[model samples]
Target: MATTSLVPSSADDPLAYRPIALVDLLDRVLGTGVVVTGDITISIADVDLVYLSLRALISSVGALTPPEPPGGAG
Candidate 1:
């Protein structure tokens, strides 16, 4: 069996394809933040038996920090 990749191979497009490490990818995602949402449903005989909804926000702690008050430091 053969699998297909969505990303273009480096051999096919060296300039356009640059593989990123998993750690680097995660770092970028966390720095910028991301929202993920999904829904799942299971049905039997056209009747819905189970349903699931999920939502999540991922970001680094520094990215979530609130700005300082409008005043000089104490």
Candidate 2:
């Protein structure tokens, strides 16, 4: 994210992320990349909608995890 700094892990360890905030990761990915716009052979107006919906769905459901706990000794 442009406004957020990367959180680092232990010194002896490799750069590990603690499951980066979904919004933050997306922001950084989008912001850092070069955005190029040109005349598309295919209709961009239609393609653009697919891109937008996919991004929205990813942000909404990507980071969530299941709440189940391990079952073993009782």
Candidate 3:
């Protein structure tokens, strides 16, 4: 049997869509958040049967710290 990696490739990698850094995630979830609102409606036989709605708010980690100066405190 041929060996294969469990990690998804670039084409279908799920992690690729998710945040990889905690700080980055926090920053977006608290500072610059994203608001998502959606609704799905399904009907069969000319009658509505299924309906779905979703809403969420994501924020980033408030303010980010400034980078320190380089050159060992010149």
Candidate 4:
């Protein structure tokens, strides 16, 4: 009898399991820009007591800046 693996090995796939450092992850996230949204609710005896909603964009200054006008500066 023979057994087979369900997941591809890193050697078999170039895009497979590569570890990224925290700094690298942050750089990529900021470079591409990301949106985070969440909601929180607190209830007592099925009665809602508090609720919160949040939305945020995380990115680098360069990524958020708009491009200059078509022609160069006036």
Q: Could you give candidate 4's per-residue lDDT for residues 1-74 as a string of tens digits?
A: 99988787888898887789999999899998999999999999999999999999999999988888988788
**Better by lDDT, candidate 2 or 1:** 1
Best by lDDT: 4
Cα error, candidate 1, residue 10 (Å): 11
lDDT of each: 0.89, 0.49, 0.71, 0.92
Sort the candidates on lDDT, descending order. Answer: 4, 1, 3, 2
The digit string of per-residue lDDT tens for model 2 on 1-74 reads 36644566556457665577988877765544433344434346565433221122232222344445678434
Model 3, 1-74: lDDT tens digits are: 99997766777865565437997776656775688899998999989899999998765334344556886657
* Candidate 2 colliding pairs: none
**Better candidate by lDDT, 1 or 3:** 1
Task: Give the per-residue lDDT digits (tens) of candidate 1, residues 1-74.
Answer: 99988888778886876779999999998988999999999999999999999999999988888767788556
**TM value for model 1:** 0.60
Please state the error at residue 61 of candidate 3 in Å: 5.0
lDDT of 3 at 36: 85
Q: What is the lDDT of candidate 2?
A: 0.49
For candidate 4, the TM-score is 0.65
